[model samples]
Target: MTKNGHRPKIVVIGGGTGLPVILKSLREKNADITAVVTVADDGGSSGIIRDYVNVVPPGDIRNVLAALSELPEIYLDIFQYRFDTSDRFFAGHAIGNLIIAALAEMKKGVFASVQELSEMMRVDGHVFPVADEPLVLNAEFSDGTFLAGEAEITAARKSIKRVWVTSNEKNEAEMPAAVPEVVEAILGADQIVLGPGSLFTSILPNLVIGNVGKALAETKAEVVYICNIMTQKGETEHFTDADHVRILNAHLGQCFVNTVLVNTAQVPEGYMDKEKYDENLVQVEHDFNGLREQHCRVISSNFLKLKNQGVFHDGNKVVEELMGLVGRPNHELRHREHS
Candidate 1:
């Protein structure tokens, strides 16, 4: 707990729609949040911006800002508003994305831009880019395949063997390192949370950064992984809850997660509108025995929310579980090895 009170310093690590979903609730809880978002995105508005600006993608950062923002709805609406297809001059570009791009140029880096914007947006917490600059996500699949962008990797739809990160710039000699503040946030937090996003892409992209993974391994803070409600098509099409933890453990080089939140509520068959919400998603299955084998303190619940024919983790329900652990670390050393 901070000198201010018992409000826990929470560092959320991941990117994608799932991130903002939970963040909005955490803000209401008045927890000190530091969202360490992925920079490996190479799709849609973010990809286009990165290509032209040579900066970290801003899409995920933009959504997170909105979630943590206390600004009036109209300002957020204008910030998020995307131009219509007919408007070629600004088509498909979000106003927020452009502002972030411009901010990156004005401030000279993604780190500073996010720092400045967080204040402007009246954000309740911190937002850190996973790295100092833009990074390209690279992957090797079990079928001996290779792909470079996050979009391309997912489009290939092969079983991913592992994923890694490197600077997006040409002639870069080494893998990129996570910004120091992000690692500090991880180490300083009372609790650390991962996922509810694409396991290999949105979530793993941040962890694959050497320093970020190192910090996670060494941090005494209690680590919680909120398992995704659905398996993605090109990613974890048939992955069990245990598979998710296994991949995270495999990448980090240890089984460090202290708790695994699994959704037990079933999705009604044919309830998902596949065409509308296509990420090749299916309800995730749980291997309780396997999770126990990983020594994970499993917390299963009906974390299901059906909104617009899509399956999502109920944000309120998820937060309720997280609050139970606020300012609490290693209350029971049943899972992870006691350091």
Candidate 2:
């Protein structure tokens, strides 16, 4: 509960490994959490399943569900279990992904199916897909070349100039719009969080959806961007934290981010296992003046958690700062209070 004696409604938008870490902590804090996940994944198990089944990729959604689920650990473990390569038929697919795929077929759509499964799993809060259907992420590189699909875009590794989404279906009349529930959640949220995930893929895919972007621009929520702790090699190599914000604002056509949470703790040299976490390149360089020029409030702290030689945000510390932003006035008033 906040100072007002009410649960603060937080809508976290993004998908990938990073999103769930924050969600699990938020659940512990008892915030009203809504996870708006990206549907633009086209890699690994998700890619294979989405291709054959004609359903939205379930990998990201499966992880988010597990993060917020109230089920026993054993049950969740079973749900999350991945098949071994020896099992050729089910190889590489998590049980939860298959289950979500089945539910999608039974429920006729991903949106309704997630809600039904959320109830069954006794999820602590809402989990909404950015759109009801699969969205293909398309990108234009600085070289003026174009590519489609998240995997290919990342692999091409050219500097990303911009990204947008299109319906996966052929002959689609128009670009996909986010379902009403997603937009409503954004508009009604007390606080909205953008990332801790891939800048062009996980995070931008959700925002490129037409209605989702519109609602974000129009909503009164204090939008917060949890900047990525490290630069992704293929996606954001040599990029500063402000470059991440700049890309997001460039895509959205407005500086929708109100505050940015940056990790100040340094990762000891040679600590990260490069072979295992190959995607991560280095710590994200800070550009406070650039962030200020973008009109974003900067909150820098030791939000780092080093585990198994990987650097990530310390969820509890990040959430503490997020909760502080709740019910607070604009930056001017906040500055006055500090002064």
RMSD of each: 2.2, 1.9
Q: Please give, for residues 6-33, the per-residue lDDT of candidate 1 as tens digits.
A: 8888899999999999998887788889
Against the true structure, what is each candidate's TM-score? 0.96, 0.97
Judge candidate 1 at residue 149 and give its lDDT: 91
Worst 10 residues of 1 by lDDT: 330-339
Candidate 2: global Cα-lDDT?
Answer: 0.91
Query: Could you give candidate 2's per-residue lDDT for residues 77-173 as a string of tens digits?
Result: 9999999989999999999999999999999999999999999999999999989999899999999999999999999979999999999889567
Q: Once model 1 is optimally superposed onto the true structure by TM-score, how far is the C-alpha of residue 101 displaced, in angstroms?
A: 0.2
Clash list (residue pairs), candidate 1: 233-280
